[model samples]
Target: MSAVEAAPRVEGRSNRGTATWMVVPALVLLIGFFALPYLTIITMSLREASTRAVYGEGFTLAHYTTALGDFYIWGILGRTLLIGATVTVISLLLGYPVAYHLAKSRSRWTSLLYIFVLSPLLVGLVVRTFAWMIILSNNGVANQALKATGLIDFPLQLMNNSLGVTIALTHVFLPFIILPLLGNLQAISPDLAMASRSLGASRMRTFWKVTLPLSMPGIQAGTILVFVLSISAYVTPAMLGGTGGRTMSVLVVQYLVDNFRWPAGAALAIIMAAVAVIFVGLYLRLTARAMRRLP
Candidate 1:
């Protein structure tokens, strides 16, 4: 080979070596932590449930059969899904404007605005759930305000139900949706909106036809994130849901820890994982069609 060609090959090899070295740590962590633990969970889920042994003695499909056949478990799954969908919708509705404002903002206080958006996440989740409990209680601030305004005579049953769970979850995951959406919105060129407006379209119409379509990617990502997180959440549901709003995550914890049914818990976990995967995959496919021709 000529000297010049040999030198390029040598440099390419060095670059690939450096890239491989950089990827090793992340690869190791994924295999050791994420992949192995997930495989262990799947293995445990396939085993029989037993009180005598933590993970059970032999493999059986009883756990899956029992869980799937139980009407009560199905009820909890439905409620969990409903809460997740509600929270995702509410969060998107509230988050989009905030994200849009943040993306278009040139104010010096933009940093402060971002902190305000993220302030709820900075607090411990347990603490936030407790705060919701206080506010949603019978004589809590909401009821008291309603009474003061002559809206009602009796205290409302706000906590220990799906409504309370939905409200709290929406508040908790709102920032998550907003951040990704803000990043997506910022990436869209402003000139596209400007050009639409220059063509005699109203600002509202321009945004409706131009900005919203372009922001679908952000919407898809944010909704999926909120949906997954809200469905899998345990603390807020356990605290506010009480008996009426137990989700799959809470049920899994009850079986695994409180009830000493690891195999059952693992089965429930796997079921949830499968459903999440299917739902997210379907979501991606639908959104993919819309985003195929992004300019």
Candidate 2:
């Protein structure tokens, strides 16, 4: 090639080099923080559980074996899955209407409504959990209101249980479901529902057939997100559920902090991560197939 041809090639290479250089910092940060720590966890998980040391010598699968054999761990895992599923379903059920209204409404109050829905998220998880503790306590506002209304003879056992954890978690994760659903609902054209109605469909029918199907992508996204977060949640469960509301994450923390079993904790954490990944993957695959079959 001539000098003129080589000049353009040199300029292209320089541009590519600049782009690579610009991305280097982000790559370094990801590897240093996220990737390295995750790899360390995997490494630590293979070690034997030790009370005195961070990790014991030699590789052993005892931690994983213990997790599998221990009925308490299984119970915690079951509770984690149950709570996560419950929270996801409840959030979706409650959030859909709010999200639909937000997407469809053109009123001045829509902005205010949006802000109100997001207000809970602005509060810290610990603060929100503490607030729930107050509201659900024996002499708290909820019981007082119930008593004033003659709804019950005594205060309900709302605190320090799975119900309290679920309630707080549902509130905490509602916005996650709503935001995604709202985006999906907004992308749908109003004319589709109108057209369905024009073809002799009732409002409910039109919504069931036309609106619901189209909003499924958002539902899938929100459900996966909420479920993952719920399964991994620790603070709300620990604060609200007390001794009975132990989940996988709480168990992991107990192993590490309370029991001083770092290897066992790491193994449990790895198992949690694996389960989440598998669940999400299967869900996505099923959702994709279902969507593809839709007309």
Candidate 3:
């Protein structure tokens, strides 16, 4: 090679080496904290149960077998999945319009609107779940308001049920979807939307054809985040979910902490995680098909 060309190649090699060095620390942390812990949990899940100890001498798949074959466990798993799907759909529907408005607005209400989006995240999750408990209790604010408005003759059963858990979870995770979506919307060039209008497309039609397609990345990211969070949530479900609302997270905690069955709990957690991975994979594929190719 010529001296000039050889110099550029040597520089490129040095740059690549530097980049690899920069990435090493992150890879170490991920493997140490994230990957290793997950591997331990997977190992725990395969361990045999013992009456005298947390695990027996040899490993077995009995935990998985017992969990999957239990019809009662399957029922809770189904309910958990249903709640996750419901929360994802609701958050997307509600978050999109708010995100879109915040992205485009220049008015005085913009700051006030931004506060609403951030307010939920300001409070701690446990504290917020407690607040929901008060609001959702039989004679609490929501039921009292309903009674005052003659919407009902008596206080409705709100807390200690799936409905209450769902409502609280939706509020808690709403901000997660909006923030990602707002970023995505703001990143979109106004020119693309404007050009669509310049070609005589109406505002609504322009959004559907141009803006929405471009924002699919945000939609995909936000929905996946919300869905995963909802499924893995423990606090809200434990606080609001009575027997009827108890989810897999709550059940897993019972096994690990209350029951002291670490192997069983680990198995359940692995099952839940495996199911989440499968669903997320399929969801990504579906969303990928709809995503517009970007330059």
Best by lDDT: 3
lDDT tens digits, residue span 1-295, model 2: 9999899999999999999999999999999999999999998899976657777778999889988898988888888889999999999999999999999899999999999899989998899889999998789889999999999999998877778888999999999999999999999999999999999999999998889999999999999999999999999998888877878898899988998888889999999999889888999999888888766
TM-scores for candidates 1 onward, in order: 0.96, 0.91, 0.95
On a 0 to 1 TM-score scale, where does candidate 3 land against the true structure? 0.95
What are the per-residue Cα lDDT tens digits for candidate 1 across 1-295?
8998799899999999999999999999999999999999989989877667776678998889999999998999999999998999999999999999999999999999999999989999999999999899999999999999999999998989999999999999999899999999999999999999899999999888899989998999999999999999999999999898889999999998999888889999999888888888988898898788665
lDDT of 2 at 289: 89
CA deviation > 4 Å runs, candidate 2? 1-24
| Ten contiguous residues minimizing lDDT sum, candidate 1 | 48-57
Model 1: residues with Cα > 4 Å off, grouped in runs: 293-295
Candidate 2: give the clashing pairs: none
Better of 1 and 2 by lDDT: 1
lDDT of 3 by residue, 47-70 (tens): 888879878889999999999999
RMSD of 3: 1.8
Best candidate, TM-score: 1
- C-alpha lDDT of residue 133 in model 2: 91
Candidate order by TM-score, decreasing, is: 1, 3, 2
Candidate 3: where are CA atoms >4 Å away? 1-4, 292-295
Q: How much does candidate 1 score in TM-score?
A: 0.96
